[model samples]
Target: MLKNIAELNVIVDKYVHWFNHERISLKTKGLSPIAYREQVLGN
Candidate 1:
């Protein structure tokens, strides 16, 4: 378990980055959530 608030924040940040930038789904055409958002929004 994380022993301090800083450690917990670090872990949360890691998971958030992974979820938005590394994780992918078939519905997204194999793109990560961030990538899919950028493509759809034309950013």
Candidate 2:
């Protein structure tokens, strides 16, 4: 149901952001992948 390439890109970007920086994982001890990575690197 995406209307155009731009809309699809926007949806992909949002999903990527959520997957990497927003959604928490129990295996990561309740941290998103990006957060876990930054924590591990002491950033």
Candidate 3:
């Protein structure tokens, strides 16, 4: 169970990076998720 949890954590981290850095969003006017989040949060 612990090993599975660790592997899941790694997968989730990779997905987070891909979503935030690589994937674009139509709702954000084609901005990457990270950029759109920053814009909305004023960061």
Candidate 4:
């Protein structure tokens, strides 16, 4: 269980980071959303 608001915020931050930067999706052809975006944009 979350002990405090600060800890909860930290947990949320980690989850958001993972969702955007780490988690791969088959719909994205096995790339994370951010990676796919970068590839599309030529970054």
lDDT of 3 by residue, 1-43 (tens): 5578889999899999998898998988999988988889999
Ranking by lDDT: 4, 2, 1, 3
- lDDT tens per residue, model 2, 1-43: 9899999999999999999999999999999999999999999
What are the C-alpha RMSDs, in order, of all predicted structures? 0.8, 0.6, 3.2, 0.5
What candidate 1 gets wrong by more than 4 Å, as runs, is none
TM-score of every model? 0.88, 0.92, 0.59, 0.94
- What's the residue-level lDDT of 36 in candidate 2? 93
Q: Which stretches of candidate 4 lie over 4 Å from their true place?
A: none
Instruction: State the weakest 10-residue window (summed lDDT) of model 4.
Output: 1-10
| Candidate no. 2 TM-score | 0.92
User: What tens-digit string does per-residue lDDT give for candidate 4 at 1-43?
Assistant: 8899999999999999999999999999999999999999999
Q: After superposition, how far is residue 21 of candidate 3 from its true place, in Å?
A: 1.8
Candidate 4 local distance difference test against the native: 0.98
The number of clashing residue pairs in each candidate reads: 0, 0, 0, 0
**What's the distance in Å from true for residue 8, model 3?**
0.9
Model 1 poorest ten-residue lDDT run: 1-10
| Candidate 1: C-alpha lDDT | 0.96
